[model samples]
Target: MHPQDSPSNRPTPVSADTREANRRQDHFGSREAIWLFGYGSLIWKADFAYRARRPALIEGYARRFWQGSHDHRGTPEAPGRVATLIHQPGSRCLGMAYLIGPEVLAPLDLREKNGYLRERVTLHFLDNDLADNDQPDVDDPLDDDGLTTARTAEGLVYIAGDANPAYLGDASDDSIAEQIAHAHGPSGPNSDYLLHLADALHAMGGEDDHVFGLATALRRRMRQAATHPATTD
Candidate 1:
């Protein structure tokens, strides 16, 4: 972690007005089924129940570990790094879209506390096999060649802005990896989160340079630490 990036520097609390605004924009009114985009820990550690899930792609955003975690992954003294979306034109993020019910909103809101706010975005599901089930209507037109074309739909995603106090902004990959290598919080070791995300992406045949790079660095650091234990005179 950066020297000034102390978790004690608590992030500005999410005001009620901001929460209301986010809810007003992303809330599903009376909609039985809602779609949610999951790119980071949500991919493998989705604590909420869902109806179905499909591989999805979202454009105009990039997954980055620029957010500080003070609860699930760290504490008030040493915050752990976590993923947050940053707008980058032409960039696409691959993840999963979950079909969930309306009841999930409350718990999700609490879980994504701190600087994270829910934002609506268009998600393209690659699978065209939703015919067996009642899939939500998509705005994108289908291809005539009978090849499976991506279907587009609006979904809610959690994002933390750079202005947020919890935002770590830019840091060297080695520095970030070093922090993650030794951080642990209420949830568990921060390295577990990185490894899980990397493994999940690999299993889906997806490659995220940032995520994979950090994971590799963290592994190397861990190996070094294990091979040469620190001495205390």
Candidate 2:
């Protein structure tokens, strides 16, 4: 559910008529702050002037290198595939949060459109501090909400169709490594994306030790596979 449309929250829905009338003003309205949870490429290239940004921890959702994409980080001509969140046990992934105003959603909507559906995700967003004129150089940090419960946040969940395969359950580490090696996007290979993610997580001080071993193994496997392809019996 959109923040404006939550059960406890009551925001006047922008009707077709209102939206049409407000089209011109949509870009001109005084922006209200909204928060976005960045997990993948968004960590690096989410475009929006933020009021505050801090390291955050989200629960009940585990990041998986599963869902594939054909856009955003990819193009039609030799398109690249990517991953998304899937339910799992004892999983915690590190990601960033952006305190953006409502005006930014319009662009984000277009960017995350197509096959991706917006779902309400429950994440513990650290009410991080911002650098206002008053709090300049105040050493912004992640705020401890001290509460880990279900909260609604608009998130795009990826679905497969455009040259994508169905969920193959929990793939073995080797299988996932193989996929990353083969997958390619507009920028580069799937392994490159994973490496970038690992780098970003490290940059944000995200806690997840699984990726370390996974990345290291993928590199060695990719190297050996390049020299000796398995003979299909």
Which structure among the candidates has the greatest lDDT? 1
Stretches of candidate 1 exceeding 4 Å from the true structure: 1-26, 130-150
Residue-wise lDDT of candidate 1 within 1-233, one digit each (tens)? 45335443334243312344455564676566667999999889879987667788899999998887767777656777889999999899989888777778778777777677888889888776652264444532222321223477777898989877677677778888877776678989889999999999998788799999999999999899999999999
Q: Which stretches of candidate 2 lie over 4 Å from their true place?
A: 1-31, 72-81, 122-169, 225-233
Whole-model lDDT, model 1: 0.76
* Model 2, span 151-190: residue lDDT tens: 3343322222222232223455565666556556555666
Highest TM-score among the candidates is held by which one? 1
Clashes of each: 0, 3
Pairs of residues clashing in candidate 1: none
lDDT of 2 at 176: 60
